[model samples]
Target: MASSVLQIVSPIKGAPKPIGPTNKKPMRPSNQLPQSLLDAARAIEKVPFHAEKHVTFQPPSRVYTMKEIGLEGCGISPIATSEPFQLFSQEAVQQCRAEIFSEPVLDKYQFSSTFTKNMIRGISAEDAPFVHALWKSPQVANAVSKVAGIELVPAFDYEIAHVNVLVNKDGEGEKAEDNVGFSWHYDSFPFVCVTMLSDCAGMTGGETALRTGDGEVRKVRGPTMGTAVILQGRYIEHAALKALGGQERTTMITPFRPKNPLIKDETVLTTCVAISDNSRLFYDYCLYRAELLQERMRLQAQWLREQKEAGAPFDTASVKKFIEEQREFLDTTLEQFI
Candidate 1:
């Protein structure tokens, strides 16, 4: 499948960077991974990562509270904007559209059953200032916080986006025959900022439908340029309604998972593991397991001591203390990942 070629636009030069503690790096094409890294990938070419059969886990019984999709419910709107909207500028929108259309999807079924073409600034521990600037904007941050009702920022704020092209064929039916992009599904990310660059005027379909907390699906079309929908995708399931009139929908989907200190530490270790071969990955994985186990043990010990001093029942308090200590450990352990 041939596609338009994407040009690696040099990241914005001389942009004011973050105030303190930055691990800055130059931006490169997503697929332009170093040859050495590509070669290293050969070790895991056919390696199967099997789970330890001895470990057992009971299914979690805690129920997630269902919330609606309006500003009161999801605390986010399907059509969203921010002050000094730089990412959705006409020039940027066209660039994003061209960028995704230029690249063919190496992995076909990345988004459930949808046929999507996407690109990212980078997807590693390293940072890309160009892409990060777009993510770190104050206006964007405010919108995100409002939706979450808490302060939530990007785990990889700048380069964490997946510039996408959701292609709904000309003659395709709105009701999908299978799950490909057409089926409603929850996103792995905590929040999803879906910016629609394609014009909805004269288009028959291609509405982005999201299932709300009330179990009703609400479909909204970005009828104008720069229209965006921000949602807690991990909570709300979404699907792209088929675009008719042979129109193609272009979107920049930036998935931002919550900032968890423990996940950051685990990511650092796992990233190191992936660099070598299957054997090295397994080694690093084991190392991480040990680190996490030690942290857990420390938390348990602390909780028991605290309970003894308080002369209180060791019930929810113990569990709560364990969780708090784990977060603190996660924050202090590894170097900053974002």
Candidate 2:
């Protein structure tokens, strides 16, 4: 397979825009979860994460590329999606669940949005140490990067381990026809690692459907417990299909960006501002952009200095291009504040 080719496009077309600033304050779920489900989730013991024992990395059985999916040159990576692969051990998943259901995490992080009714996000190291450690683990990142075909790091601390939860009481929510869990839209991040925290043995029809560039749709199978699927979601129009028959469906979504600071980062917060704590979200976004900008400027300075020492004339065109790109990056960052 050919290595991924970077295709930079600003303000990704067809991306979902924020509904409004009304959701600036965290919106609680309209309906409370059943006590039984809460008990089951909290019953698991909390254990410190140990990469050697918790991470069970295994390559996906099959990986779909942009060319294969008819979306060649669409995103930052040549790979589009990977079949479900083992990523964490059952013990690790249990610990994550325990942390998610902990009182502090549940009270502060649970958020409701038009996209997903029951979600737990904004989890940091202080809120869920085990979950945080698992995502920050180099082993886990390397495994996800291998499948994504790019060296990647978490988009930012705010995006780590965002959990989407669905509970079907008495299997009453099962639908005979296919249903959409998350409406068709592109992700805000370049890549995402979605790991399942719920058993899917009894579930059916929980695949991710991708809209090909030619308007055709292709489905990728959903991950089972302790398994995960990686996708270059920023450029792919996709949706999560509802799973029927599962008592509970919970998945951890961790967004990622290229590890190289020079890589064009088109990450936008259009889909996040409304659903997140504006203060923290903005802080993380600005800090990340600043860090990337710092590295880029430093590299550019070094290159200019080296060229001057070699008696080469200043490359005005190249310098202008860099400044323009950085200006756009700064503009994009400013736009996210609202």
The lDDT per prediction is: 0.42, 0.85
**For candidate 2, lDDT tens digit of each residue in 1-338?**
22222222333243333233246556889977778778887998777899999999999999999888877767777899999999999999989988988888989989898788899999879989998899999999899999999899999999899999988877655643548888888888889999999988879888999999899989999999999999988888899988889688999999999998877887888778778887888889889999999988887777777777777766777778778888988988887765
What TM-score fits each model? 0.48, 0.93
How do the residues 173-212 of candidate 1 rate in per-residue lDDT, one tens digit apiece? 4656643344465553445666666666666766667665
lDDT for model 2: 0.85
lDDT of prediction 1: 0.42
Q: Cα RMSD for candidate 2?
A: 4.0
Looking at model 1, the pairs that clash are: 113-180, 113-181, 114-180, 114-181, 132-158
Show the lowest summed lDDT stretch of 10 residues, model 1: 14-23
Stretches of candidate 2 off by over 4 Å are 1-25, 175-178
